[model samples]
Target: MRTSSLTGVTPVLTGSYTPDSGGDGPGIAALRLDPTTGHLSYDEVEPLPVSGASFLAAHPSLAVVYSTNETEAGTVSAVTRADDGTLSPLGDPMSSGGANPCHLTVHPGGEWLLTANYGSDTAPGTVAVHRLGADGGLLEPTDLVVHQGSGPVAGRQEGSHAHQVLVDPAGRFVLATDLGADAVFTYRLDTRTGTLERVAVNPMRAGSGPRHLAFSPDGDLVFSADELSSTVTCHRYDAATGVLTALSSVPATTAEDVANQPGGIVASPCGRFVWVTNRGADTVAAFRLAGNTLEPLGEVPAGGAWPRGLALVDGHLLVANQHSGSLAVLRVLDDGSLAQPHPPISAPSVVCALAL
Candidate 1:
């Protein structure tokens, strides 16, 4: 057990994962963090006992939580978080309508949740929308949209694959990435009715395979990770019309060799720097933002293999290395570099982290 360095407030962090045992037994884990010393201790690992859950989103206001089960018959689970960080299962899960629902988005107001279903060849892909009730549970399916397209990658882009879903800061639009289809679809969101209408569909580079997206604090630019090509694409975002125009693409891979490819991306709260993870390469790349352009700052060893997910909490960078089963901790310096890494703690196939 680690001693708590918390002074006035207790800090809790939540994580999600799929166990090696192959049953409807996916689980959510909770741990406590010492704010001053950055020490983390195991708190509770709740047994959700649901099938195929791979990602989770915590409500910003309510104590409710949402997770997606990626499968042919994908489902989203709703749960309630207690004051101590323990979770209780909420209402019955909702179907995603397509296959392999891997990513989810919660509206800024915490009133709606959306899922991106990366459908298989037979199933096709879909975006499932749901109403988040006052208590944080899902009310019902409000709308669902199917995707269609093919890209240069013969096998991977043979069909639509809705990779991620994210709502814009203004909460007026929802953006969905389709890796297989090589497109980012923007939809006008009806917050009151929980509906989405196709606003614009922007086609990416032939085989870029856009995976995940992050919006700048000012909501002027959007950054997306292109998994297959190992690049990060920038776009000028128009909040009023729900449109995105390509600005530039930054190469995530250096000359020597590329690692696990780019995955999650996050812009610093202050909007000074952007951080992206390279899984196979075991590294994290930092970029300095000048207006709308991205200048590579430097790359640092992530301290483990396959850093799939990352979180910036209290100025520290926490990396969730999925394959290595470790959490890499680093201090972000003023110049957008890393301090010497603190020893990482072993975690169970951590795919995502939510600081509470």
Candidate 2:
């Protein structure tokens, strides 16, 4: 059964670091999206308590959602999502097995949860695995693997920083992006044991600082958002052997004299284009896909500052602006360019947007 709604209104959940955790917004918020005009507003002003809910992922087999507690002593929590889009705690939080966990994903089987702990400046990052119970609650820990490496970039690359983790579209491999190490790790997860086995360490440009990656619709190619160098790397993925081979790198924006850092990336559903968010440039850049080349289509103002994450809702692109504290809605034109449908709506310290 589905929750009744006002015509075509869509529900979206937002994750943020509360003022208690050095950010704006209260906590996890439920937002109403009017797709007809790309208008977004708060369904309610109040929030459900989940401290530092920096990132969120939905369960594949249940009405549950998981979030990373992005604190010094990292933790993960699960919540039961009502059909009306309200959220409630499902269970007590579980240790993430490392510090500052930033991203998480549910395995295709819906039996395991994986998290990437982006350790602080001195500590190395780690990837932790936890089993999932029948009712969608988190079970005991299975395995934790620590990453070790450093990139050419100073300060930001002094130690390993695992930025994002996800299962490949093929469901045969696990990929984690390490920003401090300038490498993307490939792993084979033991479904029965909930353990991870290292498969390959795909290296990127020395100082690129790979943060997140998105696979092409066909799953044959991948585009990585490099934070430190403000570039996107194209990789050819061999689904049969689970191998990732870097083909090329291109600037996230063509603008000059801008100190840009790209933090988010997504591929069009049609496999015809790729989009990346530039923080310093405060804009979203679109690129046309031709074989392995990423040709610059154009750039559009992000409608705020520090655009950190993006989510697609039908023909609209929703951008989370961390600093300016607003959600920018862009219409995806037929030619792959972006245009603002209307003024951005207010959303304080919004770091991640996940449309339900």
Regions more than 4 Å wrong, model 2: 1-7
Please, what is the TM-score per model? Answer: 0.91, 0.97
**Local accuracy of candidate 2 as per-residue lDDT tens digits, 1-356:** 12324568877888888876779776788887888788888885457878888999988878888999988989999988776566789889999999999999999999999999999976789999999999999999999999999988878998899999998888999999999998998999999999999988888889999999999989999999999999988899988766789898899988789899998899999998999999999999999988899989999999899999888877888999999988889999999999963688888888888877
The 10-residue segment with the lowest total lDDT in model 1? 1-10
Residue 55 Cα positional deviation in candidate 1, in Å, after optimal superposition: 1.7
Residues 1-356, candidate 1: write the lDDT tens digits: 11223343344443445553232223566666555666666665564555555677778777776888766668888877666555678988888767888889788878888999999887777898988877888888999999999888877888899989998888778899999888999998787788889999988888899999888898989888899888988889899977888898888746365444798898887777888888777788888888678889878888687887777777777887777777777778898876655788777666666666
Q: How does each model score on lDDT?
A: 0.77, 0.89
Clash totals for all candidate models: 4, 0
Alpha carbon deviation, residue 218, candidate 2 (Å): 0.9
